[model samples]
Target chain A: MIEKKYRDLIDKLIQKSLMKKVSWNKSSRETEYYVHFKKGSFTVDNWVNDSSVYVDFTLRNANGIEIVSQTFEKESNPEEFNYLFKLYKAAEESYIKVDETISSIINELDEEDTVGKDEEDVLPF
Target chain B: MKRFRDPVFALIVYGIGLIIISFGYYFIPNDLKNIVNYISITGTFSSVYGILVAYAQIMSVRETAENTKLKIEKSNKRVMKILSVSDLSKAIKIIPEIQNYLSADKDESALMRLKDLKGILLNLKFIKDIEELTSDEKFVDALNELSIHSANLSKAMMGTKTGLNKSKIISDLDNIENQLNEFEGYLKYGNYD
Candidate 1:
């Protein structure tokens, strides 16, 4: 059994999953989760009926082309939860990492702009 | 009060009186002159002592007024900074939402919320700056503690899921929320206990 804390994390993941652009095939009764990033997106395709839960974690390029896909069955697979949790976390970290990187770049560019302003104050001679 | 408060004026008056007494010495009868001399000498000493005591009292009152003014100014600054509790309360309200976004894998939204939080913290930097400038050690230390916790929260928010300690994040959030609540209470009721 996942701890209450991990369960809560899972619950939150589900909430976000509900928000992302999802693709549903009525004939197959399959729902796909698409979480977008700057360079790529993570997609979770979940197929569920009364008896079993099947899940897939797919990495897609910026254009939504699938680059990789891993499928797991709930009854047959215990490692699915671990992988799901990892991807959820990786998605979070990558967001922060990308933001921090962009912020630093902006800061550097600002510093350079300030330097340019200072240089403008000096005579060419 | 004005006459006695001026030491220079008091001294000038004493000098003129002494000169008058000296001039009157030659006019007095020989037998009464000695008695007049004694009275003049005693009266001069008493007048000088009175003037010195009055000057000391004036100086002390001025010093006390200056000290009171300084204390009032310092407390006024403290009250001004404390008044910013409202801003802090608003900032505290954003933490939970940031956590929600981060958990749901909404990186851009979470980052946006984090940026908002960072801006709020930066706005409150003036309070820290004032506390440091005034050498209000107790308040400066408290503000420093807040800054450290805020940095930790930002780090945890940006940290990876595998490495993330949800409990720690929750605790830190609790600590920050509790602190802001305390600040608000203190501001409202003027009670620190």
Candidate 2:
């Protein structure tokens, strides 16, 4: 379930290995940064062509189960552009800091699933 | 524990102490009757023996009181359990909205996300404090990271960025939301297995 929501974001993380470039992808004229997970993804887009930036909150996997998927966009002011870079940096820093703890969570979740399965099979009812 | 604290148990213990003292009353005098200071010595000995029994009873009552205090503290551990994770869940659910608000060109809308984000962050801190108080080690880091991400994101929104850092913000929100979801799960089921 979790793997599905963040699939694209996770896929993009492959670029992290190619982090040799310290600057933005200026040539592409579009700078996008995002995080994906089980529930939904929030994307902030910087469009060089239009010289505009906005953020989109896309809810996923919440189809009939939960309608957490209303797409909301907020456009930014040019003066606020630099803050996006800072926010992204902060996000990255926070992620790296807790990376180990996150791994432990996966382990714990696996343990829970394993235990649940074991119990489910044995319950007489 | 209840039995130990009961009046019935106290009576029984007191009765036994009396019985033992009664034996001393007879035995000590019998062996010492012929001695010069026997009468005085026996009386003093029996008195001292009775005092010892009474002292023992007092000590037992004191110890019981201390145990009861400890029991109350044990019950206090559950106080933090009452700090519901539902609030935390609700707070977590707002991250995407906060992200959406961050890009708002209108100060009112953008400022609104800051306030909402602050409220959620406050809730997160509250939950974290409760977890910390209880020494709940499972999801503290996750909760803290969620708060940090939201805070940073909110701080970023505070500026007048004409463009959202599209690629990373979406994925960042996703990642943080997932972490919060994990925390919610842990709150619900992590105690098991």
Candidate 3:
């Protein structure tokens, strides 16, 4: 049984999922989820369907673009809700990780833009 | 008989006065009659002047009150507009949206989200009531800085999503947090620093 607090958390996450463009699906045959994020030099795609949960992303470097795809197949378990819960949790983690990485790039670039510049000269607004 | 109630008795005094005055043309010589005539004409003119002055004073006071009411109504309308939307709340809500796109390594989306924030800031700017609420200029400065950083962030990540400078990304993230914090602080509280 999901605790009331946990229920609230899931409901909140569900709302957030909607806002973040994460898709959730439940049909008679299968359940599915998807999250797509494109960040610096990388485009990440995560999918959780009936058969398996998979992550496919592209990484770009000097050599060339590298596409990485991994599928985590569903394993029989006593808990029916286990995979559903885990996929959502993983999506949340990935979402946060991707944000952190992009934030880093933006912050680093911001510093470069400000280096050796007088505070007064930055913006005349 | 004083003739307090009866019109006949009342007219008796006036008639007697009139008779005296009429006879006074002969009784009160020409010089005295001229003096009486001067006083009567002066009284008439004085009463008219007094009435006109009182009327003028009332009009002047009413005009001043009308002007004051108009100014107050204008100021109140401005205040109402500013309070219509919770600027602080709107600005605060945008932080997570920005962070979400950034985390997704989605600079494009992040930049777009910044546009939303920019709209919010611009809206705040349009309403002049903010000046009365807070005195610090840093609030506006912080908003402007966030806009620039957001734009630069998307532009830098535009062409090649693969060749991202890790160090640059790190610094950019820190910069974003700092600016966001500054803006949030200014909105939530009046603290500039």
Candidate 4:
């Protein structure tokens, strides 16, 4: 049996991992969640009929990461759906971390060049 | 305790003996029965020898066919890997050059570079889609890297043209460069086997 507590933890992690600009929606048969960052968007869905969850997301810069993840479980419960939503949120948060980490590294590279160019522009003949 | 049976081999030996005896009766005189018997024995041995030679030829043909198939598969994999890596390298070389020209505010040169980059990226995407035709992991990874880099470059250029925020454009360019470098590492070190 899958523990509800673990599922909840996963949900929290996904939520924290994503960018803050995320939205959620729910219907009788399905629920959808998404997050949009500077360059791309991440989305996940849970279907009531199959008791399954699917995730699709993209992270782009000059290089981009696109990922799709899906998992199915036998039992259906409101609690499980709630946990899945949390997981989706956590995944979005995680993606943001990865994006920020890459962005920061690149930013560091530009810092030196940018400062040098600024100084050159300010120099008097 | 029962007798051991070698049904097929036994049947084949018996059939050969019968054929030899019949040939001896038809071709030799009864007065020379001893000579005919010797001739029959020789004929039986010759028939067995012919059968063994035929079986060996069939096995060799099967082995040749299998080897040819393996070689063709390997060659196909090698060709696919080369094409994929070449596409990736071209994209990496072209995109940043175009971005730098744009950043330097050389509109005319940037436009020309953009055209070149776009054409190369389109070609890379096409190659990635067809990568499934060959089962070469190195080639697939290279093609994937090319496709990703192309998309990032496209986004960066479009951001620049559309007057997106300066910081955003710079960020996108940085991401593109990182992707290209990662791709280069894969190309240099990725195992083809």
Query: For model 1, how does the per-residue alpha-carbon lDDT over B72-187 read when each residue is reduced to its tens digit?
Result: 97787667656566677777798788678656856566557656765664455556423332233323333332332233344345541112333443454556566656655655
lDDT of 3 by residue, B1-193 (tens): 2222345554564456555555645665566667567567455655664565556556767777899999998778656543524665566566676666666777777777767765665565545555433223444433434433443355356531123333343343455445545544554565321
User: What is model 4's DockQ versus the real complex?
Assistant: 0.03
Residue B120 alpha-carbon offset, candidate 4, angstroms: 4.6
**Model 3 alpha-carbon drift over 4 Å, by segment:** A1-125, B1-67, B70-74, B77-81, B129-137, B160-193
Using lDDT as the yardstick, the better of models 2 and 4 is 4
Residue by residue across A11-109, what tens digits does model 3's lDDT show? 554566646545332111112223222221222333444445443322232111233322333354324245335545545554556665778878877
Model 3 preserves the real interface contacts to a fraction of 0.00
What would the TM-scores of all predictions be? Answer: 0.34, 0.42, 0.36, 0.41
Candidate 1: misplaced stretches above 4 Å?
A: A1-125, B1-50, B115-175
Whichever of 3 and 4 has more DockQ, that candidate is 4
Q: B54-138, model 4: which lDDT tens digit per residue?
A: 5655676777788999999878766755776676588667666756765776545655654564455445445443333222333
Q: How far in Å is the alpha carbon of B63 misplaced in model 4?
A: 1.9
Query: How is the predicted docking of candidate 4 categorized under the CAPRI scheme?
Result: incorrect
lDDT of 4 by residue, A1-125 (tens): 23555445345536555644334322111233344333333345433333343332222222124543334342444454555656654544453455667788788777755423566677686
- Model 4, C-alpha of B165: deviation from truth (Å): 2.7
Q: What is the interface RMSD of candidate 2, in Å?
A: 12.5
